[model samples]
Target: MIDSSANSPIVRLVGVEKKLGRQKVLKGVNLEVRAGENMVIIGRSGGGKSVLLKHILGLMQPDAGEVWFRDQNLVKLSEEQLVPLRKETGMLFQNGALFDSLTVGENVAFPLRERGNVNDAEIRSEVTRALKIVDLPNQEHKWPSELSGGMRKRVALARAAIARPALMLYDEPTSGLDPVVSDSINKLMVRLGEELNMTSVIVTHDMVSAREVGDRIAMLYEGKIYIVGEPRDVIESQDPIVHRFVNGISDASDAIF
Candidate 1:
């Protein structure tokens, strides 16, 4: 379905296919993430979740089909064209992806520094502001090794928002965290999108995170979007893939390959 308005489609993937060597990571994937809306994509591991996020962020180019961001078809953009787009898109990696060599302040300031023209004092101020937004105001001086897993994720989150991205893409935001920590991450995901007026797309397996953060949820199954709707509707959707996935029934496509 075509959404005529540019604002209606912040991210769109049409018949997109990606392959890493001989392995096909995405097969005819069709998806959309609307502006200022939070969409959580849920599926089994290796089900093309992160692959989709990477395409949207310009971190990865698809082997076939189109990946569109706003009015630009991402597949057509060169690395230089993608640079300005990077400033509008932020990604939070699964492992928090912090630089072990840098302190929290430096990590958060890295993006702005890469853009140049800003002095150290200005970068420091922005870093502090980002940290405060994530509720870790004074941890800027600490190294990533010095923080707990949840804290590290928060620091990474601060870094992601440091540049004020128009689109925020998350790869398994609550992965490798305790239930308490996961809940905190979930809250932050929701808060960032709602409180900051951002369009977000999060790839996650945590059902709790899906329910907590998604304004709408999409189920990626066997290289296609099996279902998309409100979180409750998706869970209640009786399509085999949706039912099996929602019920945690593996060995059921026994899901078709």
Candidate 2:
């Protein structure tokens, strides 16, 4: 939807391959995520979507191939070397992953606190701003336990974006929420991408969310990128595999177990 055709890729994966135990997860997968665009990744459960994201974050390295973030190849970087680069990115886990012991404000301030550059007043101000952006203004005193599932997610989002990372990675952000909550989260994601000037890589199974938030969608299937295109192009695809998955149509033969 956004004109990212002229933008250079902020993330690039070339012939990326990975294996867990005996299972080959990624097979020569290639993808390009342009700066300032929202890229949605969709695939079946346990289909390596999370694995692919880890590679981009340099949390996991591929058995073969290159994972490039900007001009640096993440695959070749030592953990020490990857520290600064990792700081430039934000990630929201599937479970919201908030610390039960920390208050909402403390949780959101965690990143800036770790950096140790911002003073207490600045951290408080940044926390307030991030929480406002996620639509949970003045919720600083609440504990994670006191909030609803959606609220927890919003808080986690606030924490992730507090540092204003150039890239944001989301893992099944709407997994357990109700439809209404899911829609709200999707809207917040779009708003954050615009307001923060972030390039996002979202891993999700929600077709509606994908279409609404993605400038482009890429489907990972059988250990490779099955297809990538605009929302309409992918949704209206004639390929049987894509059609079946997108339309939620199931065939008995698809069950490999």
Candidate 3:
């Protein structure tokens, strides 16, 4: 396990800017995720959380500024050059994003197969190990259609971790689930990070999950990060926008024309 206490950032975004179509989504955003820490990003519905996530993944280059994964600057890397770096990262999409046609085991082994050269036995072994971590062992043969929402999510998580990447990115891992199930997912995320010793950047709107899983919380408002601090600090912030968001209050009428 890497020493998470190290001050150096595993991921850093420096003055990142992006404009999607005509909308300026990210405006000079800057943030960092230290090694092996779980950094949860919370924001309003259109606060550029996903856009920022894309920059980290090297999926979308910032129109200005830099995205750095350790010493390498992602902004300078071409798609081919970025492939090796991307191999060290795993992403769990909002909806699980599993292939409906594939069985659970196949889904988990997808990354391995794409990388090629591994024998079928090794792939199956890795899949079983990952499934056990997610607490869904012996579920290899089931189709995604046969599993409940929670089970499907576990499968997605297993798939994400099968490669044993150094970093994990989760987009709304608790979305579309019951409160109890959402809490369970939150716990699983924490367990995975601890057991695998992987750094995580979770983009979520679920305050409960954010508080429970995050080592630090970053709140994005408008087009910039309004605040970044410990979950308790972020929750107890006296700032009006932060207060309104944390308490789920809206003063939209105040902005009425």
Measured with C-alpha atoms, the lDDT of residue 100 in candidate 3 is: 96
Models ranked on lDDT: 2, 3, 1
TM-score of each: 0.93, 0.97, 0.96
For candidate 1, lDDT tens digit of each residue in 1-257?
98655348889899988898788888888888889888999988888888888888888888888999889998899999999988899889888889999998899999999889999998989998888878898887899989999899999998998888989988988888999999988888778887778898988888888988998999987788878999999988878768878888887445677
lDDT of 3 by residue, 1-257 (tens): 88556667999999999999999999999899999899999998877998888899999999999999989999999999999999999999877889999999999999999989999999989999999998899999999999999899999999998888899999999899999999989999999999988999999989999999999999988788889999999999999999999888879654648
How does candidate 2 score on lDDT? 0.95
Better of 1 and 2 by lDDT: 2
Model 1 alpha-carbon drift over 4 Å, by segment: 1-7, 252-257
lDDT on C-alpha atoms for all candidate structures: 0.87, 0.95, 0.92
Lowest lDDT block of 10, candidate 3:
248-257
Per-residue CA lDDT of candidate 2, range 1-257, in tens?
A: 88754489999999999999999999999999999999999998889999999999999999999999999999889999999999999999887899999999999999999988799999999999999999999999999999999999999999999999999999999989999999999999999999999999999999999999999999999999999999999999999999999999889977788
lDDT of 2 at 50: 96
Off by over 4 Å in 3: 1-5, 253-257
